[model samples]
Target: MTVWYPQIDTSKCSGCGECVIACPNHALAVVSARAVMVIPQQCSYCGVCEVICPTSAIELPFLICFASSDNNKDQVS
Candidate 1:
């Protein structure tokens, strides 16, 4: 399954590191004077980053898929 991730708007971001600090999963970081998704896989798709961002540079999609089961348990053949 696919997962949603945070999208950083560098134009709005001032590299304040607030999102980085607010991230509970340590998925965000400031690199070269810009906030970036250092560990995309570690992100929990939490909105804390978006909320904590003073510039509103962080945008996390509403839906985040964590698990999926393709196994058909009730196949009517």
Candidate 2:
């Protein structure tokens, strides 16, 4: 199964730590003065990090749609 995770853009990131603090799952961390996805499996695709990010460095691709698809698959089985 494909899972959606946040990918950080280093060039745009200011290492503000806003996304790190906002992530409920603690999936993000500061590495080399930039935000990185430290624990990808723990991410719930909730978009909290993306929303909290000030630099727009955190990109969540198809997170909601992928999550909904996973839920539908569970219901069908």
Candidate 3:
């Protein structure tokens, strides 16, 4: 399944490109408007983008994780 992440606020952003350059999977890109997360499928949920965002635009989610061997794909958080 593919999930799309939220958009960044260009008004608050300073065009630092920190997220675009620091992305481990190269999923981010800078458009003519501002920086945007182009590919969210590569996100590892490591919160790297949230931590590096200077404008405090990134948000954290409480993910429900399941056991590695559960196989049922069930999760609760």
lDDT of 1 by residue, 41-71 (tens): 9998878999999998989867443444447
The top-ranked prediction according to TM-score is 2
Residue 18: error of model 2 in Å?
0.5
lDDT of 2 at 69: 62
Clashing pairs in 2: none
Candidate order (lDDT): 1, 2, 3
* Stretches > 4 Å off in candidate 2: 63-77
The per-candidate count of clashes, in order, stands at 0, 0, 0
Q: What is the TM-score of each candidate against the true structure?
A: 0.77, 0.78, 0.63
What would you estimate as the lDDT of candidate 3? 0.70
- Where does the lowest 10-residue lDDT sum fall in candidate 1? 68-77
User: Which segments of model 3 are wrong by more than 4 Å?
Assistant: 1-7, 63-77
Query: Which one wins on lDDT?
Result: 1
| lDDT (C-alpha, whole model) for all candidates | 0.86, 0.84, 0.70
lDDT winner between 1 and 3, please give it.
1
In model 1, the number of clashes is 0
